[model samples]
Target: MSSTAAGSPEPPSPRTVTPAVETVLAFVNTRADGTGRRELFEDGDSFADWLAEFGGFGGFGGFDGETVATDADAAAARELRDALVTVLLAHSGDEESLGEPLRHAERHLRRAGSLYPLATVVTAGGVELASPQTGVERVFGTVLAAVTTFAGSGDWGRVKACRNPPCHFGFLDRTRNGGGLYCSPGCGSQVSMRNYRRRLRQES
Candidate 1:
């Protein structure tokens, strides 16, 4: 609920229920801002709270109902999120600046992607490959699966991080041309004003 002036349009609600994209966004938006900033994954409990509230795992086929996240899991989640932000930013065309972080993220993502084991399942419609995972594996597996599916289909580009500082929130770009640059119109205006002031200073 970050604001921009008294009557400006509010930032769009963070996307948190779109299959694998949901998992990516939940981690990305963990750093809360606006009234005050707080790290949503300060610990295992907080991370678990976020998962229950917005992890969006319910639609990722099936998973173990008993698995719970740990401190290590929280740390891992943050690491993955940091790398994802870099990769997503690079996708937005800043690969030069985000190169190192992108590499670092690649390593983590590659490792996490291996946790889920693929199996051939005979569904009523036909046969297809499915990922079967449990516990921590299920948690990370669902994310990796979603990324793989989306990236292959060209929808991954629509997932992006906002450019506004202190608010690098992740959002799904639903625009016609896929040119969204901010998480909200308010953020767009904020950056616009900042650019305008810079121009004024240069002119003066």
Candidate 2:
């Protein structure tokens, strides 16, 4: 939230989920993670179902016992997720095609766009006008907006993807050196050692 020469500050950036956002994101990313493959977006039915139940931000098609059972394939999920995030989260540099979490990202953005309002007005008439109402879509929009704002404004240059190759989770890389790559210090150490070992073997 830096100030411009006009003596006014820019709008705050979107960011980490506040319990509410977390709940929705939890449901959203789950399909992509697929809990290590037990559940997956393998087809249209599964994907559509997943979107309806969880991916929809708890409101895509309404709550029901239906599960995503589409013949869509893994690639479809990956694609959808990535595209959604691309729009929902600003400057999300995650445009890779058919990654592991593509469709999840798409579901995320759609619901976000559907729910979260970019701006809310608070008139001076003692009225508190709201932008994002309550729901899954709102949650996604707010969280994604926070991420997008941070990237757009270059807020502390903090937003980053995990350096751990195996765990490519995105986060606000809050490190002093701003070089924190792995999601955790332990992962960073492991990756460093692994790289060093590989180099040693290469030299031999």
Candidate 3:
């Protein structure tokens, strides 16, 4: 079994999620931060391991595990992942918690869109947008396509990153009113306690 980063928050239990949302969350959660940080794409071999596990989501395929990811490809993937995490933080209403400006994230995503443009694919069953590129570029395109699909269906807002600092895990908010702030109750309590202590310090 793959080892987790020391102090890394436990992976949340699996929940029912569409293929698109699943793809987005899987990609974004690769960077798990805690007392220590764990990056799944730290090297070419690690990147391949991650691809072997999640590259083939339903309706989004063509990523070959054998494809060697260069350092440039890994860097590009990290850029896209970080930008997506920023967007998900906005969806959770915690944009201010992180210093990353949403507009900057928007610009990065726009640049990525140009770098990995999607092609229109029409089939008898339905219309789809897919990437014509191969290898690592195709992986990037697949992730973009998933984001586009979920955003169009209005489900994009339901995906969010945890509000707690250093534990910004991505999760699907399944609450009835969609008011989920943190990934788990433990994280919520951590934030609440931190706030309470701050208030006490102010009064003291």
Candidate 1 achieves a global lDDT of: 0.66
- Residue 150, candidate 1: alpha-carbon lDDT: 56
Name the runs in model 1 displaced over 4 angstroms.
Answer: 1-18, 33-37, 54-56, 60-67, 94-97, 115-122, 126-131
Give the local distance difference test score of model 3: 0.78
The C-alpha lDDT values of all candidates are 0.66, 0.45, 0.78
Q: For this target, which candidate reaches the highest lDDT against the unseen true structure?
A: 3
TM-score of each: 0.75, 0.46, 0.85
Task: Using TM-score as the measure, name the better of candidate 1 and candidate 3.
Answer: 3
- The weakest ten consecutive residues by lDDT in model 2 span 122-131
What tens digits encode model 3's per-residue C-alpha lDDT throughout 105-137?
Answer: 889999989988988776544567787888788
Candidate 2 or 1, higher lDDT: 1
Q: Residues 40-120, candidate 2: write the lDDT tens digits.
A: 455655555555555444223343455433353335445444454333233234344245455565566566466466554
- In order of TM-score, best first, we have 3, 1, 2
Which candidate tops TM-score? Answer: 3
Q: Write one digit per residue (lDDT tens) for candidate 1, span 1-204.
A: 112234555524333235456656755777766637688877887776766665445343332333377898888878777777777776666544375677778887787666565554564444433457655556555566566655654567788888777577788887777888888999889989999999999999
